[model samples]
Target chain A: MTTAKRDTYTPETLLTVAVQVFIERGYDGTSMEHLSKAAGISKSSIYHHVTGKEELLRRAVSRALDELFGILDEEHARVGSAAERLEYVVRRMVEVLMAELPYVTLLLRVRGNTGTERWALERRREFDHRVADLLRAAAAEGDVRSDVEVRLATRLVFGMINSIVEWYRPDGLDGRGGSGGAGEREVVDAVARLVFGGLRKAS
Target chain B: MTTAKRDTYTPETLLTVAVQVFIERGYDGTSMEHLSKAAGISKSSIYHHVTGKEELLRRAVSRALDELFGILDEEHARVGSAAERLEYVVRRMVEVLMAELPYVTLLLRVRGNTGTERWALERRREFDHRVADLLRAAAAEGDVRSDVEVRLATRLVFGMINSIVEWYRPDGLDGRGGSGGAGEREVVDAVARLVFGGLRKAS
Candidate 1:
C-alpha cells in the first residue's frame, strides 16, 4: 500500500488522510509532523490545506454530524408513523455511518477535550434528543412499550446503534454476500425486530 | 485537587492517579511522563510502583475483568430459571461496572494497540462470549426470541450496559433522590424491560 504513487492532494483528500491518522494515533497523539508524514507533504504544505489538527477534527466531526442530522430532515423520516420514522432514521443512521466510516469513527471517539469536541458532543446530544422525541411520540401513540422512560429508551437504542463504529469493519463486510448497504440494513432490521418483537419465542 | 498533596503512593494510589489521566488523555495518548506528573511522582518512581504503563493498564483491566467474570459465577447467575439468570447477570454487570467504573472504563476503551491492550480485548471478549452463551441457552429454552441472532442481541445488550460509563456521573446521580448504584440499577431495570418485553405494546 505504501508503494502506491500519489498525485496532487486536495483539501478533501487531505481531510480523509488526516482523519485516518487522527483515528489511529488519536487526536491528541497526532501532531502536524505526523499529519505531514501521513499526507506525504511538508508540515507547511499541510498547514496550507488546513489550519491545524483541531480544524481537521472539526471538519471530520462536522461531516459526521451533518449526515446524522440530515436523517431527521428526510421526507420518509419526517412524514411516517413514529415507529416507521424511527426505523427509517435507524436505517439511515447506519447507512450514513458506513458511507462516511472514517469521519464517523473519528466523531464517535471524540473525548470532549477540545472546543471542537465539545461542539461535536453538543450537536450529537441534539441528534439524540430529536430521536428521543420520535421515540416518545411512538410510545404516546401506543405503538411501542411505554414502560421505559423515553429518554432512557432512546439512549439504550442509541447505544446499541452507535456502538457499531467500535467493531463494524467495512472491509470485512464487502467480501460477504450482501450489498453495500446490507450490513446497515441488517442492523436496522435487527434493531427493529429486537425493539418491537423482542428475543422471546413467539407464544 | 493537586494542592492537597501526598508524599507516598501505593499501587492503589498510583492506579487512581493513572486512571484519571487515562480517562482524560486516553490510554494511547498518555505517557509515563504524563502519569508521573499526574501522580506527583518521578517517572522512575512510577516504574517502582508498577513495572510500566502497560502493567498499570493490565492491572486495571484485570481488576475489571475479575469483577465482570465474578458476576457470571455468582449463585444468582448460576442457579435460576434462564430468564432469572439472565436478569441476575445483567443487574450484577451494571453493579460491577459502577463499582469498578474507572477501571472498567479503561478496559472498555482499550483498542488492542499493544500486547496489554490485546490481552484485555481478548479477555473482555471471553467475558462477552460467556454472557452470549447464557443468552444462547436462554434462547434455546424458548425464552428469548429466536428471530434475532443471539450474537447480535448479546452485542447490543452489552453495548447498552457499557455505555453507562460514558455519561453517568456519580455526583449527578447523588444529587438526585438516589445514592450510588441507583444509576446502574435503573439501567439494569431498563435493559431487562427492553430485552424481555421489548418496545412493542402487548396484544
Candidate 2:
C-alpha cells in the first residue's frame, strides 16, 4: 500500500522532482536512469508520463518561459512610461524568479546543448531584447542615465535580478528562521532602490 | 612531427583546455577522456601533467580565486575610507573578471560537487563576507544607503559582476569586432557609475 501511494505521481509532481534533480545534477549529466531513481519510479512509469527526459526539459523550461512572458502582458507592464515600465518589469522579474525558483533556475542554466535548450536560449534573448528596448526608450525620454549604454545596463540589471537563483533559499537554509531570511517584498524593493538610486547615500 | 607538435601541452595550456571543457560539459559530466580528446593529448600525457580531473579543477578555480582575493589587497582597497575602498574593489572586480574571464567563469559555476568545488565555494563565501564587511563599514560611515540591508545589496552587486562570464566574449563572438564590443575600460566605468549613481539620470 505504501509502495503504491509513494509511486503515484502526477505529471506536475513528476516535473517538480525532475527539476530538483536537474538543478542538483546538471541537465546534461542527468540520464533517464538517474531521473528514475530520483523520482522513485521506474523508467517505464516516467515514459508513460512524458516521452523522455528531453520532454521533461521542454516542459520545465516552457513553464518558466510562460511565467516570464506572462509578466510582459500585464497591464502595468503594457501601459506605463518607458522608465516606469522598465521598473515594473524589473520588480516583476524578481518576483517571478523567486516564485518559480527551481523551474526558472533550470531555465537560466540551459547551455543550448540540445534543440529544446536552443529554443529556450532564443526565447531568453527575445525577452532580454524586449527589456533592452524599454531601457532605450527610457534613455530617449531622458528618464534613465545615458552615459551607460542601454544594452549594457539592461544586461547588468538582468544579471543582478537573475542571480537570485544561485543563493536564495525560501526556507532559510542558513539556519535562520523564515522571517530572518530575505522576504520577497524586501528583495523587490532592494533591487528597485539599487537599480535606480544605487548604493550611495542620497546627499 | 605534426602529431608531436599538436600534442604539446604545458600545465597552463592544459588548464585552459580543461576549463573550457568544464564550462561546456559541466565538471561532473566531463571525464578525463573528454579532457584528453579536447586537448588532443593522450590520457597518459594528461596524467603526466596532473593527478586527475580534480587537480585540473583545483588549479583552475585557484587561479580565479587568487585573482579575486588579490583585489582586496590592493592599496586602494586597503587604504581608503570604506566607500572609496568598496568602489575601487567593485571596479577592480570587473577588470579582474574580464581579464581572467574563463577562469572566473569556471569559478562562478562551481556547485560544490567535489572537495575542490567545496573549497572553492568556501573561499567564495569568505570573499563575499569580506566585501560585505566593507559595505557594512561604508554604511556605518554614512556613505552608503542604509535602507537596504548590506548583505542583500552586496549579493546583487556581486551577481551583476559575476554574470559577466555568462555572455562576455573577449573575441566578440557575436561577430562584432573587438573594438565594437564593450571595452574593459567601458565596462569598468559603467559598473562603477551604475553601482553608485545608478540608472536614474542625475538631476
Candidate 3:
C-alpha cells in the first residue's frame, strides 16, 4: 500500500526529485534506483510516496498540463478580443513556463513512450487546439495577419513559447536571459511584444 | 577498429538507424545492443560501421552543426545588407531544418550528457551568437525594431525556427504544419514573413 503523504516524503517533494533525474538521464533511462539515489532516500521510501517512476512522471506532467489548460479558463483568456486574448494567453504561457520550469520542460520532452506520456501528449494537443481556434477567430476577424494560415501560425507561436523551456534558466533570482534583468516578467513582456508584432493586423 | 564502409552498413546507413533510435528511445537510453537489434545486424557488424553509439551521436550532431554553420559563410548571408542577410539566414534555416530533420532534431535535443553533447551545445551557441550579431547590426542600422533586445529577439526567432523538429513529420511530402497547399519553401516564406513582421522597423 502507498504510504500516506508527509511534508518531507510527500508526493510533491518526490516529484521534484523525479523530474530532475528524468531530465538529466532521460525518462526512459531513469530507474527507481536512480531516483532513490538522487533523492537521497531509500528505494522503499520512494515507493511509499508514489507507485513508481511513472507515477512521478504522471504527477509532473499533470502539473504542467493543468497550468496550460488552466490558462484557457482564465477570464482574460476567455473575455478579450481574439487577438487580445491570444496575446494574453501567449504572455501567460511564458509566465507559466517559467513558474513551472522543470515540470513544463519534462512535458515538452515527452515522446509518448508510455500511457501517461500519451495522455500528456493528448492534453497538450487539446490546449494547442484551443489556442489555435483563438488564432483562427482572430484571423477571420481580420485582427491577425491572414497571410500565414492560422494553424501554422499557432504552431510557430507555440514553438516560440515552448522553446523557452530549452533556455530561460531560472536561478535564485537575476535570471540570465532577461537582458540582465531580474525576473520572467521582462522576458514575457518582450515575447508578447514580438509575438503581437508578428500577429497583429496592419492598421 | 572501424570496418571499411559498405553500402548496407556504411556510416550513412548506420547513421540513419542511429538517429531514428536516438529520437525514439533517446541517445542515453540506447545501447550498442539496442542499436544492433534496431539495425537488424549483429553487434559486431554494427561496430564495423562505426566505433560505437557515441561516435554515431557525434557524427549526427556534427552533420547538423555543419549545415547550420555553413549558412553564415554563403555569399548571400555575407555580402547582403544586415537585414537582408538576416532574412536569407532565416529562410535558409527553415530549408535546412526540413532537409535535415532528424539530424537537426537530435542536435536541438542534446542535453550535454556526454562530451559530444557539450561540444554540440558549444557549437550551437556559436551559431546563435553569429545570428544575434547580425540582428544587432540590423537594429543598429535602423533596419530592425529597437523595442526588443536583440538577444531576446534572437532567442525567440531561433526558438521559433528550431522548434520545427518537434512538429515536422517528413515521410514523403505533405508536411503537416506547412499548410495544405505549400511546400517547405512556402513555410520558409511564411516564417520569413512572420519574423520580419516582428523585427522589421516600422515604415
True contacts kept of each: 0.67, 0.84, 0.45
The digit string of per-residue lDDT tens for model 1 on B1-203 reads 55534549899889888888988888877899999888777888787788898888888889999999988878999897787798789878877887898998999988778998988888988898888898888887877777777777777778778887876666646443222334656767877777667777777
**Superposed Cα deviation of residue A190, candidate 3 (Å):** 1.5
RMSD of 2: 2.7
Find the candidate with the highest lDDT and give its number.
2
* Residue A110 displacement in candidate 2 (angstroms): 1.4
- Which residue pairs come into collision in candidate 1? A145-B199, A199-B144, A199-B145, A200-B144, A200-B145
- State residue A50's C-alpha deviation in candidate 2, in Å: 2.0
- CA lDDT scores, all candidates in order: 0.80, 0.89, 0.82
Return the DockQ of model 3. Answer: 0.42
Q: How does model 2 fare in lDDT?
A: 0.89
Q: Number of clashing residue pairs in every model? A: 5, 0, 0
Off by over 4 Å in 3: A1-7, A172-182, A198-203, B1-7, B172-182, B198-203
Using DockQ, rank the candidates from best to worst: 2, 1, 3
**lDDT sort, best first:** 2, 3, 1
* Fraction of real interface contacts that model 2 preserves: 0.84
Question: Can you write out model 3's per-residue Cα lDDT over A53-158, one digit (the tens) per residue?
Answer: 8889999999999998899999999897887888889899999999999999999989788999999988888898999899888877777777777677778888
Residue A137's lDDT within candidate 1 is: 92
Residue ranges of candidate 2 with Cα displaced over 4 Å:
A1-7, A174-180, B1-7, B175-180
For model 1, the DockQ equals 0.49
